[model samples]
Target: MKMIGLVAIVASLINVSIPFQSRAETVLSARDLFDACTRADMDWISFCNGFIQASNDHAVRLGMACTPAGTTRTHLVEIFEYSAARLLVSQSELGDAAGLEVASAIIGAAFPCN
Candidate 1:
């Protein structure tokens, strides 16, 4: 039957795709984050913002960073972009670093508590 053939095709397709999905990297790298942040696409920009905000939140909770009361999300993004660029350029190995680690370092350095 055509329906049975179609079902078999669909099942085979799903099986083929599973390995690729599993191989996808779950952790975002600093280079990838920097690329996303620098993109002109709104979707990428939004992704960058969300990722930075989440990283900032975690860093704050862990006492790794101390954001000033007047600091805005845009400010945080700027800080990350600038710092990440310099860091990635100076330390090429850091491009492979976890996004969270890079973001936390940037945030902490930008807003260190005395």
Candidate 2:
């Protein structure tokens, strides 16, 4: 069950494109998500928010996180932005980590299940 949830999240994040003669798989990176969350573009900001919400939902459903009731989207975004920034700064390698992986980690850390 946990594996299924993880697979679903991963599938949602994978971007598969088949151009005329080429195939490409583009996955969102932690750095990209961080930039999106901090950017001025509304579209990027919306995308970032959606991604964080989905990640948090998945974590909670999987018993990985226990977010407090009444947590708003804005709060989730703040948590992600702050945590992701610290992680990216301390571990350069995390910049390239899958966005879902980073988001899941942040959510879990901020709201761990007892």
Query: How do the residues 1-114 of candidate 2 rate in per-residue lDDT, one tens digit apiece?
Result: 133343344334333322212311477777888999999889988988899999899889878789999999889999888877776776655566577767876787778777
Clashes of 1: 0
Q: For model 2, name the residue pairs that clash.
A: none
Each prediction's total of clashing residue pairs, residues at least 3 apart in sequence or on different chains, is 0, 0
Per-residue lDDT for 9-102 in model 1, tens only?
A: 3233334432433533876777888999999999998998898999888778878678888888888999888777776766665666567666
97 Cα displacement, candidate 1 (Å): 0.7
Compared with the true structure, model 2 gives a TM-score of 0.76
- Point out where model 2 deviates above 4 Å: 1-24
Instruction: Single out the weakest 10-residue window by summed lDDT for candidate 1.
Output: 1-10
Residue pairs clashing in model 1 are none
- Candidate 2 worst ten-residue window by lDDT: 15-24
**Measured by TM-score, how close is model 1 to the native structure?**
0.76
